[model samples]
Target: MDDEARRDHRTVGDVDLTTWRTRAGRASASAWVRLGDRFGALPLLLVTLLIGIAIAAVCTWVASEVYDAVREADDVAVLDRPVLDFAMSLRTPGLDTVVTWWTNVAGTVGMPIVAVGFLVGFTIQRRAWTPLVLLVAASAGSLLMTVAGKDLIGRARPPLADAVPPYERSPSFPSGHTLNATVIVGTIVYLLLLRQSRRATRVWTVVLGSVFVVSVGLSRVFLGHHWLTDVLAAWALGLAWLALVITAHRLYLTALRRDGASDIHRPS
Candidate 1:
């Protein structure tokens, strides 16, 4: 759409490219609002971000520290029984095949599938830029955080010392599968809820999200790539990340309201 036509069509709740720019511009302006109306949101968002980082950092640090301590302790032998028992409980050939297939689906194709869906939203609404930016940011942010966490913790993988030809050589404090699944699925759900408020949409989003999160976490265990603790930590970290981002997005919306931009992003 041409600039003038786009601008003319933009409304307060719109989800098109122009509305996205309007929303972001409103957000930027709201960030710098001189009046006291927005004083609360900015600091609160910053604090939320800081708190998330702190939690992730502390958990990661503690995990690494504990791994070393346990490795050297005589009680290390005590852990083997429970770990083995847990692994045994998950040992079913049928489940393994299913998880293996789903794992491949989630990792190789799920993300791109989500991205393409987002692109459809962008195309239909002529808001190509907004979803594009949001998805790209989520993807980059998820990857960077996972890699950094892996490097920082430097925890060893599940000990398959002799059987594998080549194995993942990174820390396993938080499973990358857990991270990617949470972020990608979380982003899709969040965006869908943002754009559509129907009861069925909300219910389906919740159901789909719950299933994806649980299945992905379970797949990590079935694949023998992560300890239960690692998947748990990843879930915690992912939720914390999503909460911070949502908080920021809402704060930006509030800022826009305070900035006298009422007609900026209405859905057509």
Candidate 2:
């Protein structure tokens, strides 16, 4: 065996059925095709590992830049007040109640239920723990980011007076609601797509997930529970972490294909 082949053999096992499903799914994506074509079997995992690292670095850089601006209250941070004020102005007591209830349903409590339900349902359907593991990783990483951003920046939410009832006290530079929704919902859709081959289904899945994540972010702002910049940073940070997880899955598949896993092309 070549040095690279020997190295890959040591790094990961031959392809398993469930993970092979991910590889099968990616083969249909043009971007994934371009990415995979560049790698020979031996170096695929190594290259994927490098790609995941690059994604992490870019995400951290983007998040940090947003943080620095917010910390200094310049750049995009300058719009925080006006945007928030406009959101506040549009609210009436009825609207505040509606948005607040919806945010609650979509944010902290609701997201966990949806994630756990998805993990359980898919684990049953696929008879595989891969989806469960990914969900845990996505949820845990997002929660860690939320806590770290809150602690590191110690940025406060809008005054309780401006916010709807049942106010939050956490530091709010990056909205946990927005961050968690983006990571969890985004991960769910990606996994769902691995098993979905229909063009219309995939398109709708992407669209729905995007709307849900965006709604979560906007809800935080409308409720005056967070600033506009907080949600933007949350999305950028969430996307970075999601990239890391998905690429790690891709790396797993790359290892499998090296051992002769079949292409298993997407149906037309």
At residue 204, candidate 2 shows an lDDT of 91
TM-score, candidate 2, is: 0.74
* lDDT per residue (tens digit) for residues 1-268 in model 2: 3443232222112323223344445453333444555664324434554555455545555666567765675666568889988998999989888888778766678889899899988878776555776787778778777777776678878988888878899888788999889989998998787766577887899999999899889989998899898898889888988877776665554433432333434321
Q: Summing lDDT over every window of 10 consecutive residues in candidate 1, give the lowest-scoring window.
A: 4-13
**Model 2 C-alpha lDDT versus the unseen true structure:** 0.71
| Number of clashing pairs per prediction, in order | 11, 0
CA lDDT for candidate 1 = 0.59
Candidate 1's C-alpha runs over 4 A off are: 1-84, 126-128, 161-167, 258-268
Error of 2 at 186 (Å): 0.4
**lDDT (10s digit) by residue, model 1, range 188-213:** 77766665646687778879887988
TM-score of each: 0.66, 0.74
Which candidate leads in TM-score? 2
Model 1 collision count: 11
**Which model scores highest in lDDT?**
2
